[model samples]
Target: MYCLNVLFASQLNHKSILKLIRCCLETQIPILVFESIEYETLADRNHRPSHPCFKPLLFTNRLKIAVEIANAIAYLHFRFAKPILFRIIKPWNILIDKQNIVKLFDFSLSVSIPKGETHIKDVGRGTMGFVAPEYVTTRGCFNEKCDVFCFDVLLFVLLTGQEITDYLRCEKGNKFYLVYDVKKYFVNNRVK
Candidate 1:
C-alpha cells in the first residue's frame, strides 16, 4: 500500500464536467471519489436503432448535448493559461445527467500543452474508430486538433449510433487496427 501526504486538486468548476470529491491511493489500485449524479454514459444510450431497448432522443436534444460537450472541450483547450487535452474523448467518457446535461470525464490520457510547443507526441491512446490518423502515422505527434478529430467522430456516432463508414478494422490481440489506406488521406485534411 502507498500513502500520500499531499493531495492533488484540480481547479475545474465547470457544469459540464464531473467533480472529483477525493482521491485515495492507500491500496494497490487508486480509488477516486466523485460527486454522484443521476446519469448514464453516452455509450449506453447510443445503442443500435434496431435494438428493442433503443429509445430515440430528440434531434434538438442531441444537438444541445453536442454543443454542451463542444463548449466544455473548448473551455479546456483555450480558457486556461495552459491548454489541457482530453485525449480519450469518447462516448463512454461522456455522461448524460437526468436533466439532460452533458458531463465530460476521464482524464487518464489527457495532458497539458507545454508553453512554446505547438505539438506533442503521445502514445496513440485513443479509441479505434475515432483516433486521428495523423496522430498515429506521425508516431503520436499531434495537437489540439486531435481532439477536434475525436469530436467529429463522436458527433457522427451521436447522430448515427454506429461507427463511421470507409474505415476497415481487424482485431489483433483484442486491439482493433484500421486497414484502409490511412496514409493516402493524410496528405489532405480528410483523415486528420
Candidate 2:
C-alpha cells in the first residue's frame, strides 16, 4: 500500500507532485492511495540495469530529472507554512516514472520543524557522502542546509558517474577532500 503522511498529503496539489486518490485512517495502519506511477528507483537502475546493453540516458533527461528534484526540494523546504527538511536526498531515493517524471521518495528520514523551532537536535540519521559536513564535524549538529549540500553532491554524481571515493582518488596527491576539490580545481585547474 502506498503510504503518505498527512504533512505531505497536503502538498499533493502541485502538478509535478503526485495526487492522493484517497486516504484510509480506519485501521491501525494509515495508508494513502496515490496515482500509480509506473517507474523504477534510480538506485535500482544504476545498480542492476534492466538491460545488459543499457543505453545511456540523454543529457537532457538527466538535467530534467535534476531540475525536478531541485524543484521538489525547494517546495518542501519553503512552499508550506511550516518548512519540512528532507534529510535524505539521494539518487537511489529518487523514482523515475515511465514518463520520465521524478518523484522523490523515502521521506522516512525527513523531519518537520515546529513552526517556531529553529534547531532540533540532530540524530545523525543520514547516508554517507550525501550527509552534510556539519552533521559530521559538529557531531550531528546541522540543519536544512545539509540537504542543500547533499543536492550539490547529487548533481555532481549525476553529471560524472563517479562516486565520492572515485572522485577523490582521481586527485593527484589526494590531500583535498570532496567538498574542497571543486575550489581546488578552480584555483589550479586540478584536483590536488
Candidate 3:
C-alpha cells in the first residue's frame, strides 16, 4: 500500500475536513500521496478526469465510488457544525492509493460557513466541467445543492464515458433529460 510520507496536516483546519480525513484514516481508506508528484501537477494534467487508465475505472467502478464521494460530501455539508463549501469537487481533487479507496485532497479552494450565514458570496470559483450551470451562468447564490448538481454531472460522465459538452449538446431540455439521454445512449451502445 502506498503511504503519504508527508501528511498535509496544515490544511486540515476546518472541523469537517479534519473529520473526513480522520474517518478515512480510521477505516483504512487508501489516500496516500506519491512522493514524486505534487497534487498541483496531478491536477494540471487532469489525472482524475481524463487519465486513460482512470477512464476504464470510471465505467467499471464509478457508481460505487460516486456513492462514497456523495457520502463524504454529505458528511461535510450536513453533519458538521458549519457546512463546508468544497468549491472544487472535480475528480482531480480526489486521490486514490493502491487500494483504490478515494481520499479528497486539495483544500486550497475550500470555504467554511460561519454559525449563522445562510450562504456565501464573493467567491466566484469552481472547476470547469464539474461546475453547476446556474453557478456558471448566473453567478448567483449557491449552497450544498450546487455541489450535488456537479456530482450528478460527474456521475453522468463516468457512466457514459462521453465528454460533458457532448452530453450537454446532444441531450437538451432539462438536466435530468440530459442525464437520461446519455445513459440511454450508453446502454443501447453496450447492447449492440
lDDT of each: 0.71, 0.68, 0.54
Clashing pairs in 3: none
Q: Which candidate is the best by lDDT?
A: 1
- TM-score of each candidate structure, all chains considered together: 0.76, 0.76, 0.59
Residues 2-46, model 2: lDDT tens digits: 243555654645555556676677868767677788767765454
Off by over 4 Å in 2: 1-5, 16-20, 23-29, 46-50, 164-176, 185-192
Residue 1's lDDT within candidate 1 is 8
Give per-residue CA lDDT, model 3, range 135-177, as digits (tens).
6556656677777877776666555555565545543553534
State how far residue 102 of model 2 sits from its true place (Å). 1.0
Per-residue error for 70 in candidate 2, Å, reads 0.7
Residue 165 accuracy (lDDT) in model 2:
53
In candidate 1, residue 104 scores what lDDT? 90
The true-versus-predicted C-alpha distance at residue 52 of model 1, in Å, is 7.1
Better of 2 and 3 by TM-score: 2
Clashes of each: 0, 0, 0
Q: What TM-score does candidate 1 reach?
A: 0.76
**Deviation in angstroms for 30 in model 1?**
2.0
Report the CA-based lDDT of candidate 3 relative to the real structure: 0.54
